[model samples]
Target chain A: GAGVSQSPSNKVTEKGKDVELRCDPISGHTALYWYRQRLGQGLEFLIYFQGNSAPDKSGLPSDRFSAERTGESVSTLTIQRTQQEDSAVYLCASSFSVFSTYEQYFGPGTRLTVT
Target chain B: AQTVTQSQPEMSVQEAETVTLSCTYDTSENNYYLFWYKQPPSRQMILVIRQEAYKQQNATENRFSVNFQKAAKSFSLKISDSQLGDTAMYFCASTLQGAQKLVFGQGTRLTINP
Candidate 1:
């Protein structure tokens, strides 16, 4: 079975620029999530989508960060006016469902460097 | 708010030996799930093991196992017969029942030596 996949394994951008990270979840997955991981740090939750319900944006650090998932397939995380502080690895994960028992399969991640 | 803590920043184990990584969490929620995820140099998070808060019996998967202590809010992962391929960063995470988001701990880097 195909696992989760992310595009632009590495991205370098200038401060204040906007970047979009893409994620393709495994087939049939109904839940997708985005997280950020700074160097040598833990993962920080960004946003989550379950089916067609309103995405959970509670973890979005600021309004500049947003994500959208079309139906139950692909998800894109957009960071508008990116700051140097936003430099980190953006990870995407998906599970069969939103249940706690279901394990989320992660992507390779996109390392965004804001210079 | 739920929080996870991994005390050890790094650890090492010889091949065929056993090693245990400690993890603790803080949360008022009674029912939740605990997980251990391994991230190799390739940077993909892989599920190592998982434990349900309500389950009294610990969870074990082949050479990987977990010691779940609900009262202490502790979940430790024990790897037996560690292999070189086991070298990676291990993260402890927790999520409330029916929740889609996971709270993760600062990972512990485990190196398996031959």
Candidate 2:
């Protein structure tokens, strides 16, 4: 079975530039999530989508960060005006459902560097 | 606000040995779930094991098991018969009912020596 997949395993861009990271969740998955992991740090929640509805966006660091998922399948996270502080690994995950018992399968992640 | 804590920054274990990783979390919600995830060099977050707060018995999966203590808000992962492939960054996460928002710990870097 195909697992959750993310594109552009690594990316380097200048400061103030905008970047888009793509994710392809497993088929039949109705829940997608985005998270950030900075160097030597833990994973920070970014946003979550459940069946086209994102119930939680509070974890997004700033307005420059946004994400969208179409038809509970593909998802993209956009970071506008990237800053040096934004250098980190952007992780994408999807689950069978948003229920308590469901397990999340993570993608390889996109390592974004704002140089 | 809920927060997960992993006090151990790094740990090491010889092959065939056993090791334990400590984790503690704070949440006001009565019902929630705790998870131990492994991230190897590949950087994919894999679920090693999970435990529901409502269940008293610990959860075990092959070589990976967790000691879940609801009252203490502690969930520790114990790896038995450690193998070289077990080396990675282990993160502890918690999510409360309906929130689905995961709070992750700082993570513990575990090294398995051959």
All candidates' lDDT scores? 0.96, 0.92
Residue-wise C-alpha lDDT for candidate 2, range B28-75, written one tens digit per residue: 889899999999999999999999888889999999999888889899
Tens-digit lDDT track of model 1 for A42-92: 999999999999998999999999999999999999999999999999999
- List the candidate 2 regions with Cα displacement exceeding 4 Å: none
A16-115 per-residue lDDT for model 2 (tens digits): 9999999999999988889999998999999999995645788899999998888887999999999999999999999888886788899999999999
Error of 2 at B14 (Å): 0.8
> Measured against the native two-chain assembly using Cα atoms, what DockQ does each of the candidate structures obtain, in the order listed?
0.94, 0.79
Residue B86 shift from truth in candidate 1, angstroms = 0.4
Judging by TM-score against the true structure, name the best candidate: 1
Candidate 1 clashing pairs, residues 3+ apart or interchain: none
Docking class of 1: high
Cα lDDT over the full model 1: 0.96
DockQ of 2: 0.79
